[model samples]
Target: AYMNEEAVGKAIRRSGVPREELFITTKLWVQDASYEGAKQAFETSLRKLGLDYLDLYLIHQPFGDVHGAWRAMEELYKAGRIKAIGVSNFAPDRLMDFLVQHEVKPAVNQVETHPFHQQVAEQQFMVDNGVQIESWGPFAEGKNDLFHNELLQGIGAKYQKSVAQVVLRWLTQRGVVAIPKSVKPERMAENFNSLDFKLSPEDLAAIATLDTKASLFFDHRDPNMVKWISERKIHD
Candidate 1:
C-alpha cells in the first residue's frame, strides 16, 4: 500500500470493514532492516494504522540486514502482533537461504508474476518449499502492452472477461495469490470477479506459452537497481 499513513487510516475508518474479514499487509522498508529498527518500524506502522495486529507483514526487499529484520519479524509473529510473515522480491536462492537459516519459515514469497513473466521454476520452488506464491505485478504494469496482447485477449473473450481478469484468474488457478491494483471501483470489481470463472487445461497451456521467463521490470540482481534502492530511506 506504499506505506502512506493517512491513506491507511482513512481506508480502515471509512470502510468499517471488520479486521478479520480484511487482510491488511505492509512491508518493512530497507532502511529499517536492523533488529531494533525492524521492531520500532513495526510498532510505528501499527500505531499509524491504529491496529492491534497485522494480518500480514513482509520484508519489502532482499537487501540490507534481512536476517536481523527477519529475527524481529519472527518474534513479532510469535507475540501475535503479526498473524503471518513473508518476504517480497526475493529470488529463489535468497528465499531458500532465508528459509533454511531461520527458525520460522516464511508463509509467503511475493514476486513479479504474470503471463509474460510466469516464473515457472520460481513458483515450483516456492510450492515445493511450502511457501505461498503471491504476484506483485499480475498485469505486468502494462509493460509490453500486456493489456492488448492477443493471447490474453483471446483467452478473456472465451469467458467474457477482460485481459486483466484473465491474468488474475490464471495466476489464482495455479495457486498463486494476486494483488491487482486499481483506483477505480469498477476495475476492482472486475479483478475480484475472476474467481467466478475457471480456465480449462487447454486454455492454461495456451497462456503458459506466453511466458518469457524474464521480468518486465528492473532486475533485482542489477547493480544499478541495488544502488538506487540502497540510497532511499523510509521514515519511522
Candidate 2:
C-alpha cells in the first residue's frame, strides 16, 4: 500500500511542503482493528509519515472489531497522539451503532462520493451526527465518463473550468471535504483552484439532478458485497 514508515518518511522529506500547514490524514485498515493492533498501527503510521502528530486518523472500513479499535483511538486522542478520529466506508446505520457505544464522537466520515453516487442520505446522516463528510473517490475512480459528460462539460464551459473543478466546487459548496487525487502538477493546481469559483444555487440543483441513485462501484448495502469486503484481507 506504500504506507510504511520508510516510504512516508521519504515522501515527507521530498515533498518540500510544510507539515504544519498541511492537513495530514492516515487510515487504520480493518486488519488492524483491535485495541493493541490499532495502537501499534497508529504508532507505525506516525513513524512512517515522519510526523510527530496527525491531523486526522480514520478507520478504513465499517467491518471488523472497530469498537475495540475506537477505544484505542480515544486513548490516542486523549494523549494528544492524534488530533481527530474518523471512519471510512461506514454506512449510516453502522456508524450510528458505533456512535451509540463510543465515548468520543467521530470528527468525520470518509466515503466514495460523486454525482453518480451523491450519497445524499449518508451525507445528511453524518451532518446530523456532527461528523464531517470527507470524500475518497471524488472523481469516481475515472469511471463512467465523468470527465466527458455533457452536463458537466457544459457547466465547466460556463465557468471556464474543467469538469473536475465544477464537481469539486459543488462538493465544497455543500461543505464536503474533497480529497481529489492527481499525480500531475498541473492537475493538482487545477483541483485546488476549485476554491476560486463558486457554483450557483441553480447549478448545484442541476448537479443534484444528475444523481442516478447508483454507484459506479459495489453497493455497500448488499449483504453479498458486505460479506465480500469482510473476507478480503486488508494487507492483500
Candidate 3:
C-alpha cells in the first residue's frame, strides 16, 4: 500500500497504545475494488496492519466496480469485521445513486476539502443524508502558498498559532473533520494543538471568504484524470 501499513503497524506497537484506544481506518484501493477482490484486499490490509478489526474501511475512489465493492464492505461491516464502511471522492449525485441501490448508508465520505475547496454544498448534502464529511487535504498540501496566506496568517497571529493551525481550526469550526498530513513530531503536535483555541465568528467568516469553491488539485470527475486513477495498479 502507498502508506506502508506494515510500518504503521510497527509504530503502533512501539507506541504501546491500547488497541481499544486507537481508531484505525484503511482503504480499498483501485485494483481490488470488486466483491471478491475487496474481501481479499481487506484481509491483506488487516494482516499488514496486524489488526483483528478495523474502526472504519473506505473505498479509496469512486471508480471501479464500486457497487460490488460496497456489497463486500456491507457484508464485512454487518459481520463486524469493520465497524463502519464508507467511500471517498464520491460526488453527491453518485452518492445518491449508492444510497438508492444499497441498504447501508455510507457512514462517511472522504474527499478533498480545504479552505480552497470548501465543499459547502457537498457537506450540507452529506449532513442531511447522515454521512460524515471527512477532509483528505485540509492544508491543501501547501499548494497555492497556503502556509503564507495573509488572511489565515492574520487570524493565526491573533491566537498565537501558525497558519496551519488556523486552517485546521477553521475546518473544525465548520464541523468538518480534517486529517492533515504531518511527518515530524513537532508538526504533528502543532496539528493536534490546533483544537486548543477557538476561532471567533469574525475569524471564521474571514476564512470562509478564502473558499474558492473549487479543488486546488485535479478534478476527480475529469475524464482523463479518472481514467488515469482508475487504471493505476498500486499492488499485485
Candidate 4:
C-alpha cells in the first residue's frame, strides 16, 4: 500500500511490454480495511497504477475489518476487477478463521521468509491449506549478514553461484515464492538466474540447518506491533 504505484505504472508504460505479459499486484492498506473503504482503495490503487484490472489484490494486513475487506475483494474478483485476491502477514490462526469465514479462499500468504528466519512450518501450513507461500524478505533485509553467511557461501561455491542465488534457489526448491529485491541490473539478472539450477538434496538439507525459525524482524503477533501497525495511516 505504501509502494510507489505511479512510478511502477510509468516504468511499465515505457517498457514496451504487453500488459498480458506482466502481472501487477497491490494491496488494501489498514486504513481502508473495510467494505466500502476496500472498494475505494482498490480503485485508488488501480488509478495510481494506471490499470483497468489488477492481477492480484491483497489485504495488506490481518488487522482492521478484515472480513469486510475480504467481502469487498470477493465482489471485485467476481466482477473481474481483480483476477486473484489474498492477504499478507496473516498467521495460521487468523488465516484459518478467515478461510472458514469467507467463501473465496486466499490464493497466497506473503510473509517474512528466508534462510535465517525460515518459515518451514508456516510454508507447510499454507501448503496444506492450499495457499501459495510467498516470501517477502527472502534475504532477511540483510540482517545477520545473510550475504556473507558462510553456509550459504559454501553452498554457492558448490554450484558456482553467488550467495544470493543460492538463497533464492533454496527457497525455490522448497516451493516458496521468494521476492528477493535488488536495485542493480546485474543483481536482478543474478536473482533471475537462480532458477537455472536445482539445489541437491544434501544442499537443501544443509540449508535447512540455517533456519532459526524466528523472525529477525518484529513479531507480527505482538500486541505492540499490531497496535503500531494499525495506528499508521497512509491515506488522507
Candidate 5:
C-alpha cells in the first residue's frame, strides 16, 4: 500500500522495502495552487500514492496563488501531513521573494537542470539560503544532442559509464540531488549507479564548461512562457 501508489507501485511492492523506510515525494500542479485547491489536490495525490505522509511535497510551478499555497503548506508542515515542503522551477528572484516572506524556508528547489543548462548561479543562491537543489530534467530530455556531447562522451568513457550516468554523477558530486525519470527498471538501476563512482575535480570542471546558459525546455524567466503555462492545466 503506502508505497504502491501507481503503476510503479506494483514494482515497489515487489521490492520488499518497508513503507516507513522509504522517502516518498510527489508534486502539486499549478492548477491546484490555490488554498482550497491545494488542500483537495494533495489529498487526491495522497490517495493515488497510498501514502500516509509525503516525505516531500512541492509546488509544480512558481505561478498562481503561490503565496497562499505556501501558507497552506506551512500549515500542513506544522500539522505533520507533509514532512517537507518545496518549490519547482522557481528562479532566484521568485525564490528570494518567497524565502524572505515565508516563515518556514523551503527544504528544496527543483529546477530544469543539466550540463547544457546548468543553473550554477541559482544553485548557489539556493545554497546561500540552505535549500537543496534538485534537478528536474536531469538528462535534458535528450535535447541538444546530450547523448552525443563529445566532452560528456569522453568523460563517460573514462569512467566506463554512459553519458547519462556521467551527467547524474556530476550532479551528485556537486551536492545536487537528482531525480532522473525512466520507466524501465534497468535504466532506474543505471541511474542510481551514479553513487558508486566519484567524478574527479578535473572531470567536474570539464563538464562545467559545457553550460550554454539556455534551457531546452520553457524558460521560467520568460513572461510569455509563464503566461502560457499559467493559463493551461498542468498537462493541458
Candidate 6:
C-alpha cells in the first residue's frame, strides 16, 4: 500500500511518528510464499522499510505455498519479530482450513467489504473463530457511485459528516476494521474523524439493507480468476 521504500521512508520521516504509536503492516507477496522465501521476504520488507519489526504482517493472498509461509510466519511471531500475523483475501473456507491445521491462528482477515458487499456471513464466521475482520476496499473503490449514494448522504446529514465518514463509522461500529485510502490530507482527516460520531441503530439497519451479498470485484472461487492471479509474479 505504501508502494515502495521511498514512499515508506518519506512517510516515516515526515510524520515523525513513533514506532510504537504506528500500526505498521506489510505483506508477504504471493511469489514469496514458500517456507524459505517467506522468511527471506520478511527480512527484505523490514530492511526496505528500515524497521526492526512490524506491528502486523500478512500473507498477501491465499495462493502459492501458504501452509509453508504460515509456518514461517508462526515462527516469526513466536520469536517476537511480528506482533500479529494474518492472511488477506482468504475466503471463509480457506480461513477455516488454515485455522484447523495451524497452532497459531490468523489474527486478522483482510477482505473486500463495504455497504454494498457487507460480507455478513464471513464476518460472523471470523467472529466465531476469534479472528478480526479487516476491510480493504472499505469504500468499494467508488463503485456504484458510493460517494453520491442518497442513503449514505442522508445518514451523513444527520451527523454533519461526509458520505465517506458515514461509511467508515458504520464499519467500525459493526466491529470491522477499515482501511480507507486517500492521497489528500484533508480527506485523510475526514476519515480519521469518522469515529467522532456514532450511528444510530436504525441508521445502521438501513445501511445493512444495501448489501447485495456479492462482490463487485472478481470471485476468488472462479478458476479463471485463480489462473490469472497465479500466473502473474510480483517481481517477475
Per-residue lDDT of 1-236 in model 3, one digit per residue for the tens? 47688898888889999999999989999899899999999999999999999999999998899999999999999999999999999999999999999999999999999988899999999999999999999989999899999988888889899999898888898889888877899999999899999999888788888889898888888999999998899775
Worst 10 residues of 6 by lDDT: 1-10
Question: What's model 3's overall lDDT?
Answer: 0.91
Predicted structure 6, TM vs. truth? 0.96
lDDT of 2 by residue, 128-218 (tens): 8899998889888878899998989999999999999999999999888999977799999999888898888889888988788777887
Candidate 3, run of 10 with poorest lDDT: 1-10
Ranking of predictions according to lDDT: 6, 3, 1, 4, 2, 5
After superposition, candidate 6 runs with Cα above 4 Å error? none
Per-candidate TM vs. native? 0.96, 0.93, 0.97, 0.98, 0.91, 0.96
Question: Model 2 segments beyond 4 Å from truth?
Answer: 1-5, 234-236
Clash number by candidate, in order:
0, 1, 0, 0, 0, 0
Candidates 3 and 5, the one with greater TM-score:
3
As a TM-score, model 3 comes out at 0.97
- Ranking of predictions according to TM-score: 4, 3, 1, 6, 2, 5
**lDDT of each residue in 98-137, candidate 6, tens digit only:** 9999999999999999999999999999999999999999
lDDT of 1 at 116: 89
Alpha carbon RMSD to native, model 5:
3.0
Q: Scored by CA lDDT, what does every candidate get?
A: 0.91, 0.87, 0.91, 0.90, 0.86, 0.92
What would the per-residue lDDT of candidate 4 be over residues 51-80, giving only the tens digit for each residue? Answer: 999999988898999999999999999999
Candidate 5 on 96-204: residue-level lDDT in tens?
9998999998999999889988999989999999999999889998998899999999999988999999999999888889888888999999888877898898998
Error of 1 at 114 (Å): 0.5
For model 1, name the residue pairs that clash: none
